[model samples]
Each structure stands twice: as C-alpha cells, then as structure tokens.
Target chain A: MLKESLSSFLRGCRTWRLWTLLGWLDIQQRYARSSLGPFWITLSMGVMVGAMGLVYGTLFGQDMKSYLPLIGSGFVLWALISGILNESCFAFINNANFIRQSDVSLWVYIFQVLWRQMIILAHNVVVIVVLRIVFNVKGYDHLLLFIPGLLVLLLNLTWMSYMAAIWSARYRDVPQLIASCLQILFYITPLMWWPHMLKKHQWIITINPFSSLVDLVRAPVLGAYRSQLAGVLPLFLL
Target chain B: MAEAGDGAIQVQCLKDINLSLDKGDRLGLVGENGAGKSTLLRVMAGIYRPQEGCVKREGKTVPLLDISLCLDDNATGRQNIRLRGLFLGLSSEQISAHEQEIISFSELGDHIDMPVRTYSTGMRMRLAFSISMAVEAEILLLDEVLAVGDSAFQAKATARLREISDRAGIVVMALHSSPAIMKFCNKVAWLQDGAVRMLGECHEVIRAYDQFMHSKEKTDA
Candidate 1:
C-alpha cells in the first residue's frame, strides 16, 4: 500500500500538464458569468485588507506604513494556507465520478486542489504588490528566503491535503468538521494581529503550527526572520 | 468487500472470480442488476481493490464507463474535449491532434464552441462518444456505453467501437443487451450473486442464461 501511494504521488507530479490545465479550467468555470472575472476575488481581498489595515492599524496603535505590509502579506499567505486545508476535504469527493471511472492516481485530484489555490494566491499577490508600492516597503534583502520557506510550507500542506482527502472520502461529515476547525484556527492564527500581541501568552503562538507555517512564508516577505518558529517547522514536517 | 458502520457487516461485491484473457480477446459480462457485473468491471479497471483476491493486469487500461460523467457542463464542447482527453491520460499535443476529428465526428459544428449545458441529450451523447472513442487503449474496459445517441449516431458509434476494440489488445465489456455482447465479444462470463456462474463461448453462456431467466419468469408467473 505504501509503495502504491508513493508511485501514485510520483505519477501525479509527472502529470503536471493535466493538473495545471484542470486548475486553470476551475478558475475559468468559476467566473464564467462574471464581468470582472477572477479579478473580483483579488479586488475583494484587497478591499478587505485595506479596510482591516485602517481599522486594526489604529486599534493596535501601529503606523500604516509597517502595519499595511504586515497584514497584507500575512493575509495573502493565510488565504493560501486556509484555502488548501478547506478545499482538501473535497479533493476526492468532488471528483468521485472520475475516481470511480478512471485508473488515474488519486493524487491527481489532490494536486488539482493545490494548483487551484496557487492560482488564486497568484491573483491575491497583486494586493501585496500594490501595498508594497504604496507603502515603499524595502524588504528585498531577505526576499530570496521566501523561496525555500514557501517550498517547505507547501510540502507540509501537501501531506495534510492528502490525509484530509482520504479521510473525507470515507466520511461525509469530515468536510464539515474541518470547516468548523478552520474557522477557529483562523481566529487564533496571527494574521491581522501580530504575534507579539499575545504578550506573556507566547505559548499560544508557539504551539499553533499554523502560525509557524504562515510565519515561514510571511516573515521572509516582510524582511524579518523568526528563527524560533523556523526551529519548530522541521518538527511539523516529521 | 465493503464494510458498513463500525465494520459490523461486510457486503461482498465480488468473490472467487478467476477469469483470464489474452491479447485480441474480447470478453463480455452479463448479469442482472446488482449482480456484481459493474463491480467486477471496476475491479478490472483498478478502481476497487478486492479484499480477499487480486486482479493481475497488463497494458494500459482505459475505462469508458459513464462517458458523460467527466464532461464539464460549463465548458464549451471544444474545451471539454481537451479536458476529457487530459483526464483519459492523453497529452495536450495528442488531444490537439485529435481535436478536429472529435469535433467533426460529434457533428457539433459551430455549437462546439458553446457550453455543453446548452446541448440536447443526443448532442451530449454524441460528443461523449466521440471523445471516448478517440482514446487508444491496450486493455479497453467498457460498461454499457453502446446504447448512446440517436439511432443514426448509434450506428456510427457501434462502428467506432468496433474499430477501437479491434485495435485494442484486450476488450472487456459489461452489457445487458445480448446483441451488443454477441457483436463485440467471443467469450462471455455470466455473473450471479458476486460469483461467476458460467464462463464459456459467448453463444453458450447467453443461451444458458436466457433459459434460466425464462424458467425463473415462468415460476414467478
């Protein structure tokens, strides 16, 4: 069974063309009737970040320049992390017909979910770019670190998605259970609020794996390094 | 075998089924509803793993079970061709090469660029049949896909199926129609209650199954 699973994953990776086109078709079908197309998602994300930045920046007593970049990049990363987790629940259920009819690797559907979220993340990156330009965020020195960080983050997400897909395929309520858990996770993760806001309760951020995963990608883009969180990431990988 | 809640009961879909075929073999499966014909086909297609046995297969297997199930209604007929082709393991270049042939065979004309949701049932079947027949298969597994489209297109589809089956190294089809089975297969397996009740020449098995059905009907009457 382990050998079969490994070969399935390798076959899925080799068939990148299928998943890439499937992902693009998913986005196209979603916005088929809309005027602005998929940009509507980016536009809404930008509006949310902008509005939250203004309100929370004041509420937290942080300046706009630094706060906007922090929330902007962090929110984009969070969207990707949460999107993968949520959609992984349906990765097999959504393609149940194909699963029953074809002999293709089950990993194909999991990769489709990840690829679709990546496309959405690509669109949401526009908001971060606009924020960077407007706020003159100078974080080029550590930007290259984002590559390895993002790879490690995606590696963790891939396994999580695979497990969720398997479990959700068997149990009908797994998707609903995951959705509710993610709702709580969203509030606890350091997206709109900074980790330092926890003050003496630093263990909350340290214990939450999502915080470390998001920080892996977000901290690099913000030109900050969390060596402590980086130490925790290899543990999650195991 | 599949287990229900808490593994209290197991529903065995197939059991003790030992059948083999070689190159150029065309085998047909016939059984009553819920008699494990589809399950056996799925097992051969590698969709379901048997709990107590194994299915040893060689060559590439392409299943044409429920051809319309993979079509995206929101995408255009042209795009769905590419999509279905990709799902069937055809590379983009291969799909592009066969794109025109599929469109022409489906007879969609200008409507090929329109969403499949706008198609009539017959049109949808035609598109599905065209795309499915375009696949090159070494071991072709089919499930009741013969009766598709209108009568005219049904004749065309039959001819296409014949051509593809002839080219395939092995063909296994599950069908209720005796005529379809006779037309495509030289060997037959009659499944009853999750086991092979009869396996022999197509004519011999069908003849026995027909007599058994008639006797059961008379007993009920």
Candidate 2:
C-alpha cells in the first residue's frame, strides 16, 4: 500500500503541466467576468486584515504599529494553511467524473487543490507587502528562513491533503466535519490575538499544531520568532 | 465489486473473468443491461480495481469512456483542446503541434473561438470527438463513443475511428450494435450475471446471442 501510494504521488508530481494548467484555469474560470480578476483575493484579504487589526488591536490594548503587521502576515499564512485543509476534502469528489473516466493518479486532484490555494496565497502576498510598507516593519534578515519553513509546511500539507481526499471521498460528511473543526481551531490559534495573552496557558499554543505551522511563515515577515521558533523546530523535525 | 452504504453486503459486479489481449487483437463485449459490460471495461481501463484478481497491462492505455468528461463549458474550444490534451498525458509542445489539426478536423470554423456553453449539442460533441481522437494510443478502450456528431460528420467520425483503431495495438470496445462489432472486433465475449457466458469468434458468439434474444422476445410476447 505504501509503495502504491508513493508511486502514485511521484507519477502525479511528474505530470506538473496538467495540474498547473488545471489550477490556472480554475482561477481564470472563477473570475472570468469580473474586472478585478484574481485581485479580488487580495482585496478581500486586505479588507479583513484592516478591519480586524483595528478592532482587535484596540480590544487587546495593543499598539497598532506592532499589531497590524502581526495580523496581516498571520492572516495570509492562516488562509493558505486552512484553505488547503478545507478544499482537500473535495479533491477527489470534485473530480469524480475524471476519476471515473481517466486513469490519472489520485494525487493529481490533491495537487490541483494545493496549487490553486498557493495561487490565492501568492495574491494575498500583495496585502503583506502593503502592511510592511505602511507599518515600516523590518525583517529582511529573516526572510531567507521563509524558504525552508514553507518547504516543511507544504510537504506536511501534501500528505495530509492526500489522506483527507481519500477519506472524504468515502464518507460524505467528512468535509462538513472538517470545516467546523477548522472554524474552532481558527479562534484558538494566534492569528488576530497574541500568544502571550495566555501567559500561564502557553501550553494551549504549544499543543496546537496549527500554531507552529502558521508561525513558520508568519514569524519571518513580522520578525517575531523568539517565542515560537523553539516550539516549531521539533515539529519540523517530526 | 462494490459494497453497500451500510458495508454489510458486498455486491460483486464481475467474477471468474479470465481474459487477455495482445498486439493486433480487437475484442468486443456484448451483454444485456446490468450485465457488467461497462464494469468490465472500467476494470480493464484501471479505473476500478478488482478485489480478487489483477489486471496486467503493458503500453499506454487511453480510455475514451466519456469523450465529454472534462470539457469545460465556460472555456473556448481552443482552450478545451489544450485542457483535454493535457489530461491525455500530452506535453504542451505536443498539443500545440496538433492544435490546428484538431480544430480543422472538428470543423468548428469561427465557432471554435466561442465558449463551449454557446455550442449546439452536435457542435459540442464534434469538438470533444476531435480532441479525443487526437491521442495516439497503443491500447484504446472505447465505450459507445463511435456514434457522435450529426449524420454528415458521423461518416467522418467513423472513418477517423477506424483509422485510429487500426493504428492501435490493442482495442477493447463495449458496443450494442452487431454491425459495429463485426466491423471492429475479431473476438467476442458475451457476459451474463458477471460471468463470461460465451467467448469465441465474433461471428459464432453473435449468432448464439442473437438466437437467445429472439427466443426470449417470443416468450415474452
């Protein structure tokens, strides 16, 4: 079973042309008639970060200068991680027709989901740039770490999405269950709020896998690595 | 075979089926509705894995089970050609080389530039058929795709199919029409209740199946 899964994944990866085009076509079809096209991904993400940064920064008695960049980078990273998890549930089910008709490896569908989410994440990078400029955040030294961090995160998501695609294909309700679980995880993870808020209960963030994965990407840009980098190293090793 | 929703009962769709084909072999499968003809074809195409036995195949296999399977309705005919070609495992360079050939064969003219959603049923089928035929397959698994497009284009499509199948090393087709079977296949397998009821020369097996159908019809009347 392991050999079969591994071979199927390798075969699907080798067919990068197919999935890349399929992913691009998905983005095109989504914004076909609209003028803003995929810029809507940036526009919506920017609006959410702006609105939430103001309200949450004030709510938690934090300065906007430090808090805005945190929310901006954190939200963008969270969207990518959550989007892959949520959409992977439908990876096999959405391509049911092609699955039934063609002998393409099942991983092709998984890669398609990941690729489109990555494109959305790329668009959201514009929001990150705007946040950095507006807030005058400086962390260019740590930016190089983003490469290895993203590689680990994507490798973890690939296997996860593959399993989710297979499991959700069999059980119809898995997607809904996953969506609800992610909704709860969203509030608990340190996206809008600082992890230091739970001083005595730092274990909450430590135990949550989502925290480290988000921190891997968000910490580099916002230059806040001291608290979470120690926790993240062991997770990446695993 | 497949399981029920409750997972308590296992429904076997095919069993005790030992079949093989080599280069230059053309096999036709004929059976009543629900006799597992399509299921067997799917098994050969590697879409459904058998619980008991294994299917061993060599060479590239292309199953034209549903020619219109992934043709995006919002995309233009030109883009759909590239999309389908990619799914068929052709590189971008290969698809571009054959792009003009497919468009000309499809006879879409200026309509090829329009979105497929704006096409007539026949026009849509023409585009799909043209794109599917563009692949050069060593093993071709076709399920009732021969009768596409209007009558005028039907003749062109039949000739195209014949040329492609003639070039293919192995061809397995599930068809209901006896004439089509005689035209394409050298051997025939008549399936009954998930088992091969008869397997022999095409003419001999078709004769027996036709007699059985005639008697059953008279008895029903």
DockQ for model 1? 0.72
Which portions of model 2 miss their true places by more than 4 Å? Answer: A227-238, B1-9
**lDDT (Cα, 0-100) at B6 in candidate 2:** 80
Model 2 CA lDDT for position A23: 84
Alpha carbon lDDT of each predicted model: 0.85, 0.85
lDDT per residue for candidate 2 within B1-221, as digits (tens), equals: 55678884677889899998877778899988889888898999899999998999998787877655567788889998998888888889999999999999989999989998899867877887777777887787877766556778977876765675576578888888888788778899999999999998999999999898889999999
Per-prediction DockQ, in order? 0.72, 0.73
lDDT of 1 by residue, B35-95 (tens): 9988998899888988887899988777777746578788899988988888888998999
What value does the lDDT take at residue A81 in candidate 1? 85
